[model samples]
Target: MGDQIELNRRYIPRLPSQTQTQSKRKGAGARTWLVVSKLGQVSVEELGKQTVMRRTGITAHDLRVVEPELSYPAAVLRRERAVVVNLEHVKAIVTAEEVLVPNPRDPRIASFVYDLEFKLSADFSATMTREKAMEQLPTDTPPEASGSRREAKMRYSKPLPFEFRALEICLQSVCKSLESETSTLEEEAYPTLDQLSAKTSTNNLKRVRVIKGRLVSLTGRVQKVRNEFEHILDDDMDMAQMYLTDKLATLQHEGVSEDEMDDDADVILLGTDINENMSSKCSTLFASDLKPNVEELEMLVGSYFVEIEGILNKLSTEYVHDTEDYINIVLDDKQNQLLRMGLVISTASFMITVAIVAIGFLSINIRIPLFDFGTYTQWYEAFGGCVVCSVFLYIMAVLVFKFLGLLG
Candidate 1:
């Protein structure tokens, strides 16, 4: 019986602790994401890693870059169908038709959502209005009517692709955030630096140190963002891949000829076709080009790059960094002045010590000829002579120090 019990104990599996179970659940948790589309509607949904991969056509490694918990550097990666953005606080996946933002309830991200809805819906409304006007025109219209349409078309500006619009919002939000932070830091930093320069104290030094640290961190982040922009600008192919709408249209045009076999293959194709059909009558619709052009995206990114560069310059060398250098120079000069003053005082102390030693020796009971003169006049003479000798020694020390160029 004992042997059987021992065998049973060894064979049975051990259950994990409650803490371990909870940690596992948290690690593999489902996250909520906000889906914003051209319709100007925002929908909240819970999604897992697998679901995100399936929706975005990205791998697990690419998805990890945008995870909010991870401390990944600024990146703008273009996948086959989506653009992954991880700039500072904005973590999102932008597709040709919509954008998926994680943690939409976050206060930092609220502005992005608002801008996306307002701008995208407004563009869609404008496009719809233009299409409707064109559709109402007569098929056998006269030359004058066509001329009016052409004039109206010329007056209307072209709307950017949906992907570009979403990307633009993200860049704008990041740049705006950076600028606001730089301004706030400047307001606090300049005063602190000025106060420190005027009066060096423990409290003021601490404040300057803290401000400098923050500026350094901010500069690094700005540099990373700028580098990402430059990386995209340098590679034409990378920018070309970012043209999701154009690529979708090209794929759709090809799909009609080859007869896509799988039903799943037609999902994006059908969506693109429906969108193309709706805007076909509009004169400003983006046409399908045989070769992809990146000029549009290049111009967009280049503008933001300039903006970010301005912000970085403010943090790096224009304002805070320059102030720090000036403060250092001021502090060094003050230190030298203090040292010289101390040296002068030390010389005066040495001269006083010699006078004090002579006076002490005469006051002793064993004094000989110096105390022989009993009158108070002799005492006064001795005191005056000590004072005169001390003054002479101090003046000589001052002249020597000045000659050595140590008292400047």
Candidate 2:
């Protein structure tokens, strides 16, 4: 009976098998997945346990968190083609629609779409639709409705079309994060000219402009796709100015915090001084604080250089052709002068020969009382020497005039 009891104990129904227990434990530890989609297409899968992104058949590192004060794991992802950042890390999200309107600050008019899902610990997930994402709200609103306003505000001022504006805003956020992070790194984390030049079919001409004080550096390719969409008008120009004003305000706020942390008011004071100086300079140069579109400004400068080059080429060609014609005319005049001189020399030589022959004939035909061979020969030689010297002097004068550029 005891043996039977032992067997029954071993086969108890209350306890599971070792294998079954192990399988259950493994299943419990399995990580949850969050689907991140753009325009109804899955772009990335976020692993809950690892807090890492899995995309394009590859797994990347966890994004770096800048501000840990937020409730979520807000981070900045710096990738090869784009930057990805969670909006939760942002201190504040401000939307200035006044900058977008026609009469005020003309911001780049764009349409945007966004769809974000929040997955909680209890397998409960809620999604914010594109329509909800487009609405601008006060800072105290619930997280479920905000929909990346911090990132969206940076790129656009007005409502955009679904999916299109979302992608652009995301891209712009990524670029801003990259610029901010790279400014702190000691070594270059991006591609160099050598690497960029060697790649095939690489769009190397594109660049990202990083503004620090008065200096700007182009760090990434200005996407050709974005260029196709950028059309600036007076409204856009006004919007750009407003954007700059908004950025300055944000910078001042952040800078004040940093200054407080450092216990040094010098940074803020210097910043103010610089601002005053810049304002004065801008007024002197541009006559207004309204900023121009940088891309349009660059295009204008490039067009000016091209036009100047064309004008210079035309002028150079005309000058060269006219110079050649003038040279040809001068050369013809020199040739005529040489021909005239030769004709005079030939006539003088003929006359001297005749004179010599006549003198000889007169000596043979009639004996003159005072005439002698030696004296007559001497006079003939002297006259011949004078004619030769005169010809040499005339040739030298022509050469001098030619050297002085008087002939041409």
Model 2, 218: alpha-carbon shift in Å?
A: 34
- Candidate 1 residue spans exceeding 4 A from truth: 1-29, 137-148, 156-158, 256-292, 317-322, 352-387
lDDT of 1 by residue, 273-343 (tens): 21232223111223433344788898999999999999988886555566667778888988999999999
lDDT of 1: 0.73
- Please give the TM-score that candidate 1 achieves against the real structure: 0.75
- lDDT per residue for candidate 2 within 201-258, as digits (tens), equals 2243232112121121222222221221232222334233323223323334434332
Candidate 2 global CA lDDT score: 0.33
**By how many angstroms RMSD does model 2 differ from the true structure?**
26.4
Report residue 216 deviation for candidate 1 (angstroms): 1.8
The estimated TM-scores of all candidates read 0.75, 0.22
Name the weakest run of 10 consecutive residues (lDDT summed) in model 2.
97-106
- Listing every candidate in turn, what is its Cα RMSD in Å to the true structure after a full C-alpha superposition? 14.0, 26.4
Q: Rate the local accuracy (lDDT) of all candidates.
A: 0.73, 0.33
